[model samples]
Target: MMEFRSVQGSLIEAEAARNRARETRMRRALQRILTAAEGVPGYAPMNWSDVAEVAREALDADRPAGSNR
Candidate 1:
């Protein structure tokens, strides 16, 4: 049916948009890490695991308990 086709098309478009936004965020995060590490001594480039761990730590640090905002 035409209605079903329209819904499917919309879902596909939405998914594509989500994927693009995720990629943009990831690229920006990587750029930030690279910039932060630029002048540090004995520093090596990050791998995916390193990036994931750092991001997890950052997220955990930013969250506080007791009150929900």
Candidate 2:
């Protein structure tokens, strides 16, 4: 039905918006992390594992106790 299509479209739009917002936040976080790292003596660029670990730490810090977020 037309109503179902409209609802589906709205959901798609919302998901796209969420994806965009998440990407922007990630970019900002990466920029900040790299900027800080640059100030450290003998700083090296992060490898994939290093990046993953950092991401996990950040998520854990932001996560509420007993919440899966």
Worst 10 residues of 1 by lDDT: 60-69
Alpha-carbon TM-score of each model against the true structure:
0.58, 0.60
Question: Best candidate, lDDT-wise?
Answer: 2
1: Cα error in model 2, Å: 0.7
User: lDDT of all the models against the reference?
Assistant: 0.68, 0.72
Misplaced by over 4 Å in model 2 are 40-66
**Residue pairs in clash, model 1:** none
lDDT at residue 57 of model 1 (Cα atoms): 53
Quote the lDDT for 8 in model 2.
100
lDDT of 1 by residue, 1-69 (tens): 999999999999998997786666666666657855684555566767877776665444434665453
- The per-residue C-alpha lDDT of model 1 at residue 66 equals 59
Instruction: Residues 1-69, candidate 2: write the lDDT tens digits.
Output: 999999999999998997786677677668656865676656566766777776776556545688875
Checking candidate 2 for backbone clashes, the offending pairs are: none
Would you give me the overall lDDT of model 2?
A: 0.72
